[model samples]
Target: MSRDATSSLAAQIDARLSAPGAMDAARFASFLGGQQRLGLTHGGRALCRHLRPYLIAEHDYAAVARAAERIAAALERVARRALVDAALAEELGLSADERALAALDPGEGPFLTVGRLDMLVTEGGFSFIEYNADSPAGITDQLLIEETLMALPHLAPLRRGRGVRAPAPHRALLCALREGYAAWGGREARPTIAIVDWKTAATSAEFNVLADLFSAEGHRALILDPDELELDGGRLSAGGERIDLVYRRVITQELVGRRGLDHPLVRAYRDRAAYVANSFRTKPLNKKAAFAVLSAPEFADLFSPEQRAAIAEHIPWTRRVRSGRTSWRGRDVDLLELIGAEQESFVLKPNDDYGGKGVLLGWQTPPDAWRAAVRDAEAQRAIVQERSRARTARMPTFRDGGVAEEEVYFDLCPFVFAGRMEGAMVRLSASAVSNVSAGGGVTGLLIVDDPRLKREDNRHV
Candidate 1:
C-alpha cells in the first residue's frame, strides 16, 4: 500500500475514536479499571492509556512476519556458526565465560526457541533494529490487553465482524516450550514449566500472569527466582517441584555474571537434565553486533542469496565500534573518522544491554558528549548503527478528564517462536526511544482484515 493508504486506515481508526460518545472520560476510566483488575501494567503504570489499540493491516503484518522469519533464520545460522568459528566468535565480542557456556551442549532445541525482533515500520518500509533472542518479555499481558479492549463498548464499532484479532504470542510460547521439552526426550503429556527470573524484577506481574495461564492449560507451572533453584539427585527442582521445562527469563549474561559457570541452571542444561528455551547458544546472536555481522560485507558469504537479500533490505548499516576500517554504503572508510564526521546519522549502543540502557542516539546528543561515547564504545563492546526513522501517528491519548489526539512514535515488535512469526507488541513513546521501561506505553496490536483492500491470503489470526 502507498503511504497515503496506510495513513487513511490509521486516520479512520482515529476518527472512530474521536467520534462523540465513543471515548468519553468515564469510558477511559473504566478501561483503566479493567486493566488494573487484570494487572496489565508495566513499571507500576497501566500498560496502555490510549483509547484505541495500534491498528495494522493483515497484509502488512504478513510481510513483516516474512521479513522477520528470514532475518531471524540468518541470525540463527550465524549463531550456530559462531559457536565453533574462533574468528566469528571474536568478531561478536564474546567473553571467556560466555564462550564457555555457549560452547556447552544444550541437548536438544532450537538455538532460540522464543525471541523478539524490534522493528520500525515507516513509509520507506520495514527496518529491523535489534534482536532479543536471550529473554524476550511482553508476551502474556497482550492477551489480557486485547480482551480488555474488545470488552470496551467504545471500541465495539470498529471491531464488530471486521475480524480484528490480536496475535497470540502466549499460545506460541506454550507451543514452543512443549516442543522443546519433547525434543529433550520428555514422554509426559505436559511438562511442568517454571517461569524463572529475578525476584525483584519490575515485570514480576507478567510472570504471575503467565504462570496462571500455564496452570489453566493443565501444566504444572511455578514462578521462582534463580536463588530458589536447586539440583538434587541429578535432577532440577525449584520450589519443591520438578521442572521439566524452564521458560528462562533470566538473561544469560546476568546468570553467568552473578553465579558463574557452575550455576545449577547451567549445569542442569549442560547435563540434559532440563529443557531450556533459548539455550545458552543464543548468546552470540543476542548481541547487537549480530546486526553488524549481517550488514558487514566480510560475512556476506555466510548467508544464501535470499537471506542476503533480506539482510540488505531489512537491516540498516551497522558495524562494531572499533578503530579499524570498515565498509559504508559499499565503500571502505576509516570507521573512527566517519563516525566523528557524521554523528547525527548514527546511534551508539552497548552490544549487550536492553530497555534503552546505555543507548546514545547521536542526533539527540551533543558533539562533545557523542565523541566521548564513541571513544568509550571503541574501547569496549559496542555497535554504531545508522539511525532508522521511527514511524509516528496521531493516537487518542487520555488525560485530565478528556481524550485528545497526540502524535507518538510507535514500533512494531514481533514475537518469534521456534522460527515462526506469531504475535507482536506495539510500543508508543513521545521521544525517539520507544520502550516500556523508558517511559513508553504498550498497546495490543490488532490485525484487522479490510475488505476494501486486496487479499494476500485467507489466513486469519
Candidate 2:
C-alpha cells in the first residue's frame, strides 16, 4: 500500500468515526458492558475503551512477521550458546542458580513454546524492543476484545466491507502447548494441563480463560499456584490430579524468589519428568541484556547473514549498563561516560521487569535523575537502549458524554508460537511507556486485507 492510500484510509476511518451515532456514549457504554460480561478485563478493570481495533496493512504485518521470525531464531541460538559458554552466560546477566536452572535439559521440544516480541511500528517500520519469551500475556484477551468489537452495530461496515479480521493467537497458543507436550514424550490423547500462577496476581483471570480453552478442547485443565504443585517420585500433580503439562505463567524469578530454586516444579523439570512451555532455559533471552547481545557487533558472528540483517534493521543500539568500554558504531567508547554525556538518546531499563517498572527515558528525566538512574542501572546490571519511536494513532476516546479522537502512543506485539507469527496484541497509552499494568489500554489488532486501506503517515500500523 502506498502513502496516499494510507492517508485516504485514515481519512475514511476518521469520517466514519465522526458520523453521528457512530461512537456515541451509549454505544460505548454497551461495549464496555459487553467486555465486562465476557471477562475481557484485567483485575476487574476494562482492558480497552478504544472504539476501534488497531489496523495493520497485510503487507506491513507480513514484514513484521518475517523480522520477528528471524529475531526469534537468533535469540534461540544465542540462548543455546549461553548454556555452554560461561562468558556469554555472564554477559547475559545470569546468576549462578539461574545458569544451573537454564542448563537443565528440558527434554525434546523447542526451548520457547510461545513468545511475544514487543515492538513499535513507526514511520521507519517496526523495531522490536523486548522479547517476552518466558510467558507472554494478552493471548486469550486479544480474541475476546476482537469479538466485542465485531459485535458493535456501529462497526458493521468495518465487520463486513472493510476486510477487517482478527488474528487468532489463542488457537496458536493451544497448538504450541499440545506440540510441546507431545515432543516432551507425553502419550496422553488429551494432556492434563495446569496453568500455574499465583492466584493473587492480576493476570489470574487470564489463567481461568486459558483453562476454559483447554477444557473446551477436551483436555482437563487446572489453575494452580506454584505452592499447590507437588512432585512425588517423578510424578507431578496439582491438587492430587496428575498434570501432563504445565503452562507456566509464573515468572521464573518470582517463582524462585518465593519457592527457591529447588521448588517441586523445578525439581520435576530438572528430572525431565515435567513438560513446561518456555522452560527455564528462556532466562538468557528474556533478559533486557539479550537485546544488548543481539545488537552488539561482538556477537554478530553468532547470527546468520539473514538474522544479522534483521538485527541491524530492527534492533536499536543497546548495551548492558557497565563501567567498562564498549563498541558503538564501529568505535570503542567508555560506556559510563557515553551514557552520562548523551542523556537524551538512551533509555535505562531494569534487566528483568514488566509493566514498565524501573524504566527511565533519558529525554524525560532531569539531568541529575538521569545520572542517578544511569548509576543505578549499572549497579543493577540493567540495559541502556537507543530510544526508538513508538507509533501514535488518533483513537476514539470517551469524554464527557461523548467520544473524541485523541492521539496516543501504541505498540503492536507479535505473538510468536514455536517460531511462527500467529497474531499480534496492540496496547495504547498516553505515556511513552505503554503498558496495561501501568494504566494503559489494549485493543484488538485487525489485519486489513484491502489494498486500498493501509497505514497512515508512513507508519506500518
Tens digit of lDDT per residue, candidate 2, span 385-458?
98887768888767887768779999988999999998988899999988888988898776766555433323
lDDT of the candidates, in the order given: 0.84, 0.84
Cα misplacement distance, residue 413 of candidate 1 (Å): 0.7
**Alpha-carbon runs more than 4 Å astray in model 1:** 1-12, 455-461
Segments in model 2 whose C-alpha atoms lie over 4 Å from true places: 1-13, 329-331, 451-461
Per-residue alpha-carbon lDDT of model 1 for 1-461, expressed as tens digits? 23322455567666776677777777787888777777788756788877677777777778788888999999998898998898989889899998998888887667789889998877678789999999888997678886787566656665565466778999999988888888878877988888888998778888888998899999999988988888888799976789888889999999888988888899889888888877898988888999999998889999989899889888999999888888887678999989889998899999989999989999999999999998899777889999887768777877876678788898888999999999888888898889888888888777766667666652312
Error of 1 at 412 (Å): 0.4
Q: How high is the lDDT of residue 337 in model 2?
A: 93
